[model samples]
Structures are given as C-alpha cells and as structure tokens.
Target: MTQTASMSQNGARGLVRGGALDVLRFVAALFIVLYHVAERAPVSLFALHPALSRGYLGTDFFLMLSGYVLARTYGERVLSGGVGTGEFLKRRMLRIWPAHLVMLVVFVAFVLGTAAIGLAPQNPQWFQWSQLLPQVFLVQAWFVPGISGWNMPTWTLSALIVCYAGFPAAWRLTAKVRSPWTTLAVGVAIFLAVDYAALAATGIPGHQLPLRFGLVRGIPLFVLGMLVARMPTTIPSRLADGLAIAAGLGVFALQALGRFDHASLALLSLLIYAAGASGAKGSAWASLAGRLSFSLFLTNQLVAVVWFGAQRAAAARFGFDATMLWLTWALALPACVAGAWLFERLVDTPLQAWIKRWSRREAAVPAPASEPIAA
Candidate 1:
C-alpha cells in the first residue's frame, strides 16, 4: 500500500516519523509495561523504587507526545484548509480505532472462553453491558468510574479520540495566542489548577485517580504539548541535553516523593521538548521501536493477563514461593516486546493498509448529480 500522505495535504510527505521522539516513545512504553508487572518484583525492591510504582504516568507521557505530534502535523493541515477536519478525524480514527476495536473484541472473547472453562476473568467490568458499551464506543474515560475496564490502557485512546475530535477548534484557538510563552504558561496553569482542585477534594495526587478520569488527566498535558510544538524557543544541543537531564531528574524526584500530579506532567513536557526540539536524529532501532510502541502499549495488558494467569497456575501446580512471581517478571518484558512486534506485523500494519486502500477507493467515487427542477 502507498505510504500515508503528509499530515498536511499540501506539505511534503514523511514528517510524521523518526527522531529522538521515537526513542522516547519506546522508553515510555517500556516503563509502562514494567509498571504493570511491578507486583511481580520483590516487595522491598518495588517499595524502594518510586519510579516503578508511578510508572503508569507513562500514559501521560504518551498523551503529551501525541498532542505535540498531532498539533505539529494535522493541526497545520486543518487550519490551512489543506485537509478538512472531517477528513482529519477520519484518518486519525483509522489510525487508532480499528486496532482498539479488534483488541476489545479479543478481550471479550478471551474472557468468555476462560469463563466457559470455569475460570472467572479477573475484571468483572468487562462483561457488564453498561461499562462495555461506553468502552466499545470509546467514551469510557469520560464516564466510567475506574476506567480500567476491558483493556485498561485504552483509557488513553478514549481520551485521545476526544482530543482528536476537538483538534480543529483547539488548533484555531491556539493559533490566536501571539506569545508562545503565554500559551505554555496558560497550559501549565490549567494543569496545576486541576491538580490542586483534585488534591484539595480527594487529598491525593491527580495522577493517582482512576484511569477513567483520563480525560482530565490528559487534556492539560496535551495542551502543553501543542504549545510546546508551537514554541519559538530553541535551545542549543548542549543546553537541550542539560535541560533534558534536569527534567528527567525532576520526573524521578516527583515520582519518588509521591508528588504524582501536574509536576509530572510539566516535567514530561520539558523532556519531550528537549528531545524533540529542532528535529529527531533518526536511527533504525529507534524508528522500529517507535513503530511498535503503540501496538506494544495497546496489547501488553492482555498479554500480561494471560501470562500472570499461567504463572498462577504454575504456582498452584508446583507450590513455588515468591520466586515464581519474580520469574514472571524476568520473562514478561521480552514477551511483551515480542508479542507487540508480532501484533504490529500481523494485525496493525495490514489493518491500516486495508483501511487506507478502502478510503482511497471511497474518495475516487464520483458524487451523485443534483436533480434540476422541471421547467
């Protein structure tokens, strides 16, 4: 199949891929996977590492990255009328929803099959119609309570769909801001205000809230990301490296201190900008990881469910101690990476190409003629 055209219809093709951003995406995805498997690690080690516990903030990292890339790419196309908002939405939906729906179905089927064999699926919400309907429609993050229903990680996808739907208007509004710093400050303030309000109400860090609250969790960072993309400030490589290191340290400190709130979001924005500013220095490995990261993020939880279930079964059969859990930890990461790579090759890539082919065919069809009134 032909490559996806440039995000802007008029711009040159192939701006979407490569750079340090790819490396960052891969790392963020890996962090999230390890976060999910943290329970398998030794209690003392897990307790000591705040970064691993709060690693779910990796999703927030993804949201910021998404906002930056989408704004830099599609934002321009929509604003310039090079691509209609409807077309933009269609393309974005094509990029995300097919794979999401496929996995959603797979999860449901897996649950049912396990139930048939007399094993109760771990998450009961998967079978509830009330919860399943919203998730199937990709609005679970807006209304669901825990938001970890079905494939839990998809809360990000649901929130992202909302963001994509609003991108045209958001981009228009963002363009009106004359000063990039003001835009950046406003975005940061909105995030902090929301964080403060959540803290005051619940006495918990906002990022610790249910995944269903991902709508709130995602928006400010997303806005900040877009503003970062729009920023005129360009730090030299030496300074960018320093800032990146500092920001990385800041992220660790925030997580370590259990301040998993807007500070985490702010630090993530800085890290992404430091890595992505100017342009990405592309490499084969980084590009491969970037290509697989989405599939990895989307599929890992399902694989973990199966893997952990097997580990439990093994523990039951063999009477092993905590070592089995640690064994699962040793194996799970590579399994996830391999599984995600296969999913990308077998499912994600071909499904995307098929949709693109169908889209082209639909676009080629002539519109029906309007009827004239009889004289």
Candidate 2:
C-alpha cells in the first residue's frame, strides 16, 4: 500500500473498527460459509452441536451493520435533502454491481461446466434455464428458488436492494416524526411486531421473515443502525471497545446455543448500534477487519462455496473425510483477506473519486487558485 493510503487506513484504524460488530460481520459471513460447508460434508459439524443453528442470523448482523453505516454516512443527508434517492442508489449500485456481475457469471459458468462434465446431478428439479436468467438479474428471489439457482447467500444482496429501495420512503416517514429516538423506536417496534405478527398469521415456522428479497424484514434494523450513528455525542473509545467485544460474543453465543429469539436479536441489534456509536477506540483488529468488511462479506462466501465444490469433488475423487475441505477453508482465509484487500483497492477506493466527480457534476466545485503568470 502507498504511504498515503496506509496513513488513510491508519487514520481509519481508530475510526472504523467495527469492534465486536465488525468481527460479527466477518464472522457472520464465515458462519454462513460454514453452514454450507457442513451441509456439503458427510455430517454437519454444526448439527453435532446445538449451537450451529445460529447460521440463520448472519442476515441479522447484516441489518445491524447496515443501520450503522446508514446513520454514519447518510443520516443527516436525509434532513438536508442533498442526496436524492437516485444518487444514493447509484452509489450503492456502483459498489455492488461490478463484483456482482462477475460473481453471477462465474456461478453460471460453474453450472455449465458441471453440466458438460456430467457431474451435474440429475435432480431435473435443480437445473433449469428459466431460473438462471433471473438469478443473473439477482431478482430470482422475487420468485421461488430452484435448486439450480441455489446461491443461498446471494439473497442478501437481493434483500439489501429491497432495503435500499424502501429507504427513501422510510426516511420520509421517519423524518416527519418529532423526535429521532421516537422515530427509531417506532420503526423498530413496527417491523418486529408486524413481521412477527405476519409470521404468526401465515404459520411461518421461524422468526426470520421469508428469507428472500425481503424489505420488511430488514428496514427496521437499518433504521436502528442509523439512530446509533445519529447520537449527539461520539461514544468514548474504551466503552466502544467493550461493546464491540460484547457484540461478537452476543452473536456467537446466541448462535452457539441455537437461539435467535426476538429478545436475543433485540439485544444483538442494540450492541451493533452501540459499537458504531463508540467508533475507533474499540480494538485494533476490529478496526482493520471492519475496514475491509463489506468487501469480505461480499466475496468470501463465493470463494468458500467454490472451494467447497472443488473440495467435495477432490474428496470424492481421492476418498478423504473432506480433509481437503478443511485445507480449502484454511487457505480461504488468506485468500479472502487478499481478495478483500484488492477489492478495497480497486472497487472501494474508487468510491471517493466517484463521489468527488459526482459532487463536482451536481454541485459547484471550488475553482483552482489562479496560477501566478510568470514574467
């Protein structure tokens, strides 16, 4: 890294450590990979233990994380009315789309290769062209997921898109509310209550609303994150670190025990916002980890899933207890770190430049100081 970028990161090191929240983000992504990983194994490592059920909560942490960033980055923008819905979406799309397009193509290619080699399972049900098209669109979740298009974690991207779509409307409603705290409270209560009530009415078995492209399930959590960011005073560093640690344990422990009840999740969400409010002083690793976290979250699962497939094949071919699978996951950590680094460099770093250009084009840019005319 260049000295400037390094220093920028160093400055951020204190500011962005997600504390436990950041750790939870990376861990959440890894846990999702593990859930899939265990599923591909002869026996689930998680099933042997009761705590493995927490894999479903990755999206919950995501909601918390989203809330934090929204408040940190854009909370005030809502009232000031500078960032319009379209511009906000444009930035979001730029961040997500480039990699998403590549990832989508890669999956499609994998499916095709599997089919060509006769390795594709004859589930007739799992493989279909109709589903592939929409999966490419990242809109497949709007309909049912066919086995052929079964990218389980990609649903996060789809659901986030829904949340982004709803944010403008939600902002209007929340902004009109008299108090920021009241806005946050009503939003959280409405989502949880309405979601749970609807789940009860529909006889849905679990607390998570339908796992696909779901706005209703996510918006409240996003709002809570923003509320944390909007707090009048920055959280003290020492306290932030403590909450950061607590957030990680909270998510991990809940997941370990196979619990994500409304109460547990409510607590979890509070910790997430708190960590964000705390900001930089939390912990060293957390700040570093959180810095590249979004990149890590988006890319790690694909690597893990791809590695999982390769390991499954290699294991089947070589007759192993998925020993290679272990090796792949082991290797994947560094690979994921490296990928995140590159993504931060190529995709994320460009955000500032993009924002500058966007600002220049929309708002007036300060003129350069006139050069002294040399005689």
lDDT of 2 by residue, 1-375 (tens): 001111121132222443555666766666665555555555666668766655556666677667666545554565578677777777676667666666566656777887797776433454467766665666654645444344445656665676777676666666676676776677567666766776777765233656543444555566666555444334565776687667657766765565556656666666665655454435667656666766776666556556666666776788765565566656656666677677667866676567558867865644557953211
Candidate 2 residues lying further than 4 Å off, grouped into runs, are: 1-22, 121-127, 143-150, 205-207, 231-235, 255-260, 279-288, 321-375
Tens-digit lDDT track for model 1 on 119-152?
A: 9865565566557878787888885764356777
TM-score of each: 0.88, 0.76
Worst 10 residues of 1 by lDDT: 1-10
Error of 2 at 58 (Å): 1.6
Candidate 2 has its poorest 10 consecutive residues by lDDT at 1-10
Clashes of each: 1, 7
- Local lDDT at 197 for model 2: 72
TM-score quality measure for candidate 1: 0.88
Candidate 1 residue pairs that clash: 19-280
lDDT of 1: 0.75
